[model samples]
Target: MSDTGGLFDGVLAAGPVAESVCDGAWVQAMLDFEAALAWASAAAGVIPEAAAVDIEKRCRAEYYDIAALGAAAVRIGNPAGPLVRELTASVAPEAAAYVHLGATSQDVLDTAAMLVTARALIALRAGLHACADRLAQLAEEHAGTVQAGRSLLQQAPPVTFGLTVAGWLGGVVAALDRIDVLRGERLAVQFGGAVGTLAALGDNGIPVLRGIAFRLGLAEPVLPWHTERSRIAEIAGALGQASGAVAKIARDITLLAQTELGEVFEQGPPGSGGSSTMPHKRNPVAAVLAAGSAAQAPGLVATLLSAAAHEHQRAAGSWHAEWRPLTELLRSTGSAVEWLCIALDRLRVDPARMRANLEASGGLLLAEQVAIGLVAAAQGAVGRQEATDLVAACCLRAGPDDLAELLAADEVIGKYLDRSRIDELLDPTGYLGSTAAFIQRAVQDWRSRSAGYR
Candidate 1:
């Protein structure tokens, strides 16, 4: 079966990055390397300049039959052989002699892979930046909007929604930084001729390599890394981390958008987040799709990591294994980030519902704060453990009676505390310790980091 045009393609592999890694793009990238090689060889006096121009003119991917190239590639175990042969045949005889000079099939394909990766990364970075910007806006706008903080799937204390959004922003910024570093420093050209040595091109090899690097806007490595797959593995790992970050944010949205909670809703266009059978269901479809797309990344990353163990100077099957997994990884990761951006942009918050939920536990959520307050108010009259036990007992009776009223009526607690004092202790707004500060710090850090990204 074919890999493209699935029912879920628009949901799982949607974005410009998908196009950048398609079969046509791969063929074009290989042709680009061949054209660059010819021009670089001519610049280094290794081939005629006229031959370079002739070869360059024939290097357009639109001129070649991509399906026929794939069919021919099966015989040679790679598409580079068929591509180079076709490219050579398409050009004049002198240009054909100069096509893919002093470069192995591996060199052409590997370099083409780098080209494809660099372009796809550009699209991924844009999606990440869009998500980061939306998160920053939500963080700043809701910096003071208090909500119940849950731990282990149960309500615990209070935290601002801004702080939660800030947390998401921090993760996106971190992933963006890693991707930036990889794009700037690690995308090196792969040109080692045959077996990691440019023995065929003699002394002209280094110059041609430099020329190719300059022409393609890729880094010039000290040596070709035929067997070293760290660059590919690193790319996989970074995209994996990015996908994880997107999943975390999306999962939070799905949880918060639950029907029972009702604290947040995804305000997308009509017909989105719909259920066919269940008309009342307004599912968090964007977040669900984002999470599903991200869920596919870890296994793809593992596949790339498994292929890292190449034998000797060149891999037999290991190198061949990286092609499809890496492409899918890039596409899936890009789709996840894009969906997350859409989810956050459409998110609607309910402060009233958040406050109502915060008060749902009848002051049991503030048991810890009340205990600490009792200890301080008692002023050594009651020990810390005594105060803790007193508060725990009061919490047990909180649903039948208000925890504040229960604590104020307790014999041991009533001596040092009044109803007003207990009320203040149980106030979620008063108990959001360091929340605003943390939100500020998170927003500042994101702004500082995103400034460079912009």
Candidate 2:
């Protein structure tokens, strides 16, 4: 990313997750597994405590040459073999014998992935909760603030801005809940020896697995899942869904902030989002970055899905296929969360503009309201379609003072309603039915769910 010369460094990739899944972080995670394994073996009485301490002292990632290890991995096919080989050489012969005694390369690698994933999820949770908080606040503040609802890109009827933000908050809350579940249930230690059977440890294998889980703060699995890949697939799907949720907010904000409908504004510094040539352009740069991350998500998730087709006990190529793609997919989701948080936290709302735009349609949106009001007043005199067409036809002609005035001057429907009732029918603010109640429900639901999560 540094070599790319600040492509999305600050915009998308500047979140808490960027550091947790870096190359350096991967190296450290793998090294931590080797040390944790030694600790687990000692606790299980499979290896002497003194030898475990000796091996642990030298299991630091810094002791290994990073570049040389990467280059050596090209011939061996993975960095794990070279890393283990170097770790073995770094320890005394007595200690080296027990360094990776009961484990295989996949155990170290899979557990390392879980470690990185756990830390990154913590960051993701924080970012997601922050976004939810912002939306919750907006929902509460704008509960009664009226705006025009649109369908197929055209104005339809009246709605509260709060309800729209509530929808976005609900999606983020759902995603957060599912990701937390996956973290709790699927984040188990991977410790199957050689071919999914702990042949090296014999009867001590299960005990060693429990020991590793306790030491690493992970969960113990029912069995070693070297070949079963549902855990990884489920997590990838959750992240993919989360990315979609993030993109929804971005898409809505970008759409609302268009020149013709200046309902919101993107957040950035003065010089940020400025066009290269246009002097007055302030583009929705945050949304652009989030959209880019989402655009990459489906393909990255596909790679993980395709890689699930692993062979027999261990996959040859398919197992290798997961490394780069899974990391990239997680990175893309991380970036989306990070950028969406920034965009949401500092969002600029224009309630006045929203009101103005709703009324800009000149009561065309209030046709349904007027028609329904006429029916209630008419009893049996005004037919539904007749009232509907009466208001619809009024939309095409010049009005007296406003829509209500024009409706009152109508030939047939005017006999049913007086001026005060017409005013009620034409009020967009009054027509936002149950918007505040829905916002409160969404906000309360989020509070309840997130309280349990925390």
Instruction: State which candidate has the highest TM-score.
Output: 1
- Candidate 1 lDDT by residue in tens digits, 400-434: 34777888999988888888888898888888889
Q: Give the 10-residue window scoring lowest on summed lDDT in candidate 1.
A: 396-405
lDDT of 2 by residue, 317-346 (tens): 877888887777777788898888878865
For residue 430, give model 1's deviation from the true position in Å: 0.8
**Residue pairs that clash (backbone atoms under 3 angstroms), model 2:** none
Best candidate, lDDT-wise?
1
Candidate 1: list runs displaced more than 4 Å: 1-4, 380-386
In angstroms, how far off is 253's CA in candidate 2? 0.9
Q: For each of the candidates, give the backbone clash count.
A: 0, 0
- Model 2, 70: alpha-carbon shift in Å? 1.9
